[model samples]
Target: MKNVAVVVQDGAEPFGLGSICEVWAEPYHPDDDNPVFEFVVCTAEPGRIEGGSGFDLFVEHGLEALETADLVCIVPKLDFRHNDPRAVAAVRQAADRGAIVSAHCTGAWVLGDAGLLDGRECTTHWRHADELAATFPKARVNPDVLYMFDGNILTGAGAAGGIDASLHLMRRTFGARAAATTARRMVVPPHRDGGQAQFVRTPMGQTEADTLAPLLAWVSERLDEPMPVERLAAEAHMSPRTFARRFRDETGTTPLQWLTGQRLALAEELLENSSLSVEQIASRVGFGNAATLRHHFAASRGTTPQAYRKTFTCLEEQSA
Candidate 1:
């Protein structure tokens, strides 16, 4: 987590490369406690590399920088169908030596070329999902998800999905609070569940007035209250059936699913920022009981509440 290297090859997408730098190489933080990664931009071939944007970038570091990187990030390249063998080898060697290797968008093709995607769950932009699956049959390519974290390797979809994936790595390595701080600085949500679907078929010509934004904000504030769809629909001044349909159309998820995500996010905030007991936190977040909270928390986050607290508890408070 301390050392991070972003691998850029010729025709690299600028935004994908910038996303890694935004999350890992940002110089200042409002909290002053964020992890400072020793960030380096490295390439297989040093000197001027052409970018997808019809510009060139001067990459000073070669593959040697990846040897000590705790995490190696692969930015999407325009010509991902073919990768330089030297770059592929460096990526494979880094992963083989236990460094976390992540790919953004078509960069998964690089992992596939390196044979790192074999037997691993992964994802990429929906446009390229079929090709990725066809090329790397052993890789379980989930087209619906924004990102996938299987073992030490992570794969993100396109564009903003890279930010989501990188922030997730920050959360896992640092803590929820740190991740939240970083997201706040970037003005984005800290943790978007990786299971969230990448595409939403919004109704054409949808006006801002028809949005469920107000209702969503209302529900988030009242997470501790009873929130059956009937009640929620009433609050939105719509019939239950219409509300359900509109919820899916607007949010790309069911009402209950969105509520659960919000509750889980609240639970995570409490877990990081407060001294509330598990039972108290569960009640506060409307889970009603510790057992129920534990079940959902483990299922969604891959860790129990107690374990999460142990790993992410504020160090100063613990020392005090």
Candidate 2:
């Protein structure tokens, strides 16, 4: 994960490109001790690349810049439906050679254009998710997630979800500490538990007073305690049925499902940083027992808690 190449082209989204650069293009600082990346912003052609935001960028590298990259990122563009054949081929080839390839927002279109999304579970900005699904029928488009990774291909939802995906890669390749350090530097949350569904617009027109954020924060602190929908509804001062409806509207998942996800996230952090026994962690995270924790852990992560801890600890040690 040391070498990274970001593929951009004409009509590039400035914020998307800048987000990728912010994460991977940092110079080594003695204080941070984070691994530096050999980051190159390449295009299919070297020279003036027109931006979607009425500006132009001059790029020096061609598709060849991807040859030795450990990670290849596709930056979103306004005209995402059309992509250069050469750039698409380069991205496909990069994935073929075992490099992790990621697409941010509408950049999933490039992976789709290259036939890389076939039979893969992927996502993009919710606005374009339907179009992407329609265009690539073979791709299983999950429009609700902030980010998803199927094998070597990573796809992020819209906007700040790019930061979530980037930090996730860092966490997986390095460790929780490294990811947290990077996130602190960027002033973003190291891990965001919910999906992009929370950000999608709705006809109901939700306001700050209607937000469930405060209740979520309160629940997050008490994950160790049992929380059924009725209890949660009472805490929110809503009936169980009304609470269920609003919970899905705001979080894109049911209360139990969302709680499971939160518990899994907390379990991961404990697995990475704590020396507690698995049973202790399970109890702390509201799973009650190690068996229940292992079941959900295997379902969500495709690995057991013990194996996950071992892998994270090994990566952390290697990075250190």
- Global lDDT scores for all candidate models: 0.85, 0.87
lDDT of 1 by residue, 230-310 (tens): 999998999999999998887778888777777877777787778999999999989999999988877766667777666
Best of the candidates, TM-score: 2
- TM-score of each predicted structure versus truth: 0.63, 0.65
Judged by whole-model lDDT over C-alpha atoms, candidate 2 comes out at 0.87
Residue runs of model 2 more than 4 Å from their true location after superposition? 205-320
Q: Name model 1 segments beyond 4 Å from true.
A: 193-320
Considering every candidate listed, which one attains the maximal lDDT?
2
Candidate 2 lDDT tens digits, 101-164 = 9997999999998889999999999898899999999999998788999999999989888888
The superposed Cα distance between candidate 2 and the true structure at residue 309, in angstroms, equals 33
lDDT for 295 in candidate 1 is: 88
